[model samples]
Target: MKKKITVALLTAAISLSLVACSNKENVSKNEKLEDTVVVYTTHKEEMLEAISDEFTKETGINVEFINLKGELADRVRSEKDNPQADVMFGGDTSTYMQLKEEGLYEKTEPQWKDELDKSFKDSEGYWYGTIKTPVMMFYNKDLLSADKAPKDWSDLTKEEYKDLIVTRDSLSSSMRSTVCALIENNIKTKNEDAAWKYLTDLDKNIKNYYNSGSVMYSAIGKGEAAISIAVLSDIIDNKENNKMPLEIVDAESGSVVITDCVAALKNAPHPNAAAKFVDFVGSAKVQAMIANDFNRIPTLDSALKDSPAWMATDYKAMDVDWDVIGKNQSKWIEKWETDIIDNNKVEKQ
Candidate 1:
């Protein structure tokens, strides 16, 4: 599906104008403005630009973003003495859990509190979930027809797909969290041995592990890898924008649904502007815009009703405790690196 440019045209225009008019010798008046919001986000550029532009248009406050794919929390903690960003956006709930534990965010009342589900937001409003990004697998459409594609996570262990699957390195926090969920939902729920056995078996088919999700998806799109695991949004964006021949498979066993959350720094340089930006992004209007144009599952109930037909509606969220996952993250990673990973490498060799 093509992006609906009509929703964010002025944002693109303003972004281009800012770039084209760059002059170190002569700083523009807008650059000199004091009330700008500095955003640290993991959102894709398109999503960031659109939301920022609309915030600028409505509040007359400029938005500057620093893209941090998976390290926003650590970066914010490092900059605690001198907060560089007013807000952090688009990391998953686990990211927010860490931030909340470390007291990195300020509790603020969001405009969409009533519209959002209680489970999706922090009880005290430290962070809020904006959209649902499900964990799923995709295959190269050119190489595998729909009927031939793997039906679920367990199917990935089949011998036919041996050395044909790719995924982000388990070292990455996002990938690690995904691994934890897979173990929790697919294996540990029934028995630990079953989960370990499944992961070890699946590892046999992993031909490569990518450092970045983008590179992994690119490999699958180019048919360099026939199958890969990724987020639903990434697959949609790649197929629509890059014309990548990819098709998504909702894990028939059940899929873990995670959300991209937004929060404001506890000691933000621009506190009021940060609050405004957060509220604007969480508002029904912007959430609806995201749902319609980008095919993301919105957190707002009203936005869900307004979402585009292409956006999925009937997928079951895996029953897992995010708090338990967040607390045991380090231990899980250690086990993965020592046991699961070590065993997989030896077997493949």
Candidate 2:
């Protein structure tokens, strides 16, 4: 009887030990999953690193990022069957809309979703805008005074400004937004032909089309080109940080404000980490930090309040329908590339 009792006690002890071991293994797996997040971004490296560092400090989750620039959207699409990144950060709302239509984004509402305006986010909570980037014209102040600089998009096509303008390649989202806004505006007021005519004339003055923003910035700074169009944030950064002789041209037609957005991938390798990252990036606190630190215009109302005083400088916003632009973006881009860019007779100066 004594031997049987001892044997029963040993069996109970072994079962408890096995159960504890299984629970520990489960906990270890979860911890490993939450420790790091992989991100694919189109944002500049400095801004990405700054935001990533802050997120790491706050959440203790490491960030590994790839700056894919123009290739970001295509890469995401190619990897739809098996996603490698946890999050997709940067790129304008229009791109996000296209991706959302393809069902590539995971619908996860960040905590700060309610703080943004309806225009800044998707109604279905697929993606959230973190920055408001205005696509506007700017010039090298040393080369041309405010009075002489192009006051509107039409001014670039003038005979006097010929060979004085440098433009980004059409692949740039900023350039696409600017061109689409002009096209949409013409479609509303006149007809599509009017928009094409304007673009064709504008192309006549182009000294060169640069595939890299940095190269274009250098060309303007060095007086190789006197005027160009760029996002307001980049203009400010080049002027203030890099000491580039740049000035903003508040176009009479107003600027097209691109809502730069963030979203998690549909079958992300680290889903929990991706959800946390999406929430953390668009949070009011981080938004405000980005605004103050990087000269970015925050999309969140509360964050906008904490932004720099320059953000309060009022300028007219182009009255273009973003939904319409999002839907026909590919078609417009294709036509522009084939007709305007490819077939242009203008020789680079």
Candidate 3:
């Protein structure tokens, strides 16, 4: 009884390089690429620069941004001597936790540390989630229809949906995290093999596999694939302003939730600016950028609204142990590669 595997709709698998430009739009001592503040992020370029520009407007801090790609953790670690980023923003909380273990964070500033969540945030004041993104089921409304869409976790194998669901390779860090949680819960009969079997069945149903997080939203939006698991942030942000019938669902069976946060490097070149960036993200205005403007949930209380539909719903999520994610990632990735992807065990519905 292998458990089901669904990739959360993360806003971006993007490496947001924040090149700080002054509002003056000229290279000056305080704002030039070499002289200005250096910030690093993996957020989408549009959102990253939009928010960074706002910060520049208010503070007059000269900024230079570099767009990063590939695994941020690897990049940051590899550049230990000449680390490029002062603040890492917009990655899953688990990555932050893993970095904290590696001693990457400075751990000075605190953002409602104990109050928001004891488990999620760092106790030493290293990192905190500025916005949250919960994992939920996303299906093409036209294909699934309200009645045909999944309302529960087990719906992955219904007679009608046998070959309708689509998902990522289980080896992906995003999907692997959620899968570990699923296995831990014994959701697939407390037997990991059973869980793998279920994943295989769902894998067979997938029409295609994607390498980028944005592809999920794009796929579902265009009806290229009928169903997928995604983070709420990606789905909502990519949601058409012109109008499209894309739909995201929260299952009574449970949805996995995660948050994207900001963390300062332990010896950041611009400590003052780094802390300010965290506070800025924590503010309602910035939170709104994540929620109303971007479709991710605000971490602060003021940004929340009455609506909790889809990714917004106040559901029971795993306590979100970043440490667990860091340790188990290699094991899960290896298993998924050998058992599924490498052998071409994956299928398309």
Candidate with maximal TM-score: 2
Q: Candidate 1, overall lDDT?
A: 0.74
- The superposed Cα distance between candidate 2 and the true structure at residue 276, in angstroms, equals 0.6
Error at 273, model 3, angstroms: 2.8
- TM-scores for all candidates? 0.79, 0.85, 0.75
Where is model 2 poorest over a 10-residue stretch in terms of lDDT?
Answer: 14-23
Weakest ten-residue segment in model 3 by summed lDDT: 1-10
Report the number of the highest-lDDT candidate. Answer: 2
Backbone clashes, candidate 2: 0
Candidate 1, residues 1-349, lDDT tens digits: the string is: 0122221242352233232122224233453433467788777688778887676666666677777665666678888877867888887787688778988998878767877888899988899998888877889989899998998888999999988888887545557768888777654567777877888888888877777677777678677779987777777778888888888787777777787889989988778778877888988899889887777778887887788765654665577778767766656666776777634332121
Shift of residue 67 alpha carbon in model 1, Å:
1.2
| Per-residue C-alpha lDDT of model 3 across residues 120-188, encoded as one tens digit per residue | 477778888777767778777777788878886567756677556656654344566566555544433
lDDT, residue 46, candidate 3? 67
lDDT of 2 by residue, 1-349 (tens): 0011121243242223111112223222444446666788877777778887776666666677777766778889888997867799988887898999999999897888887899989999999999899988989999998888888877888999988998888768788878888899988888988889988888888888887888889889888989998888888889888998788888898888898899999988778778888998998888898998888898887888899988877888888887778788888988888888744533333
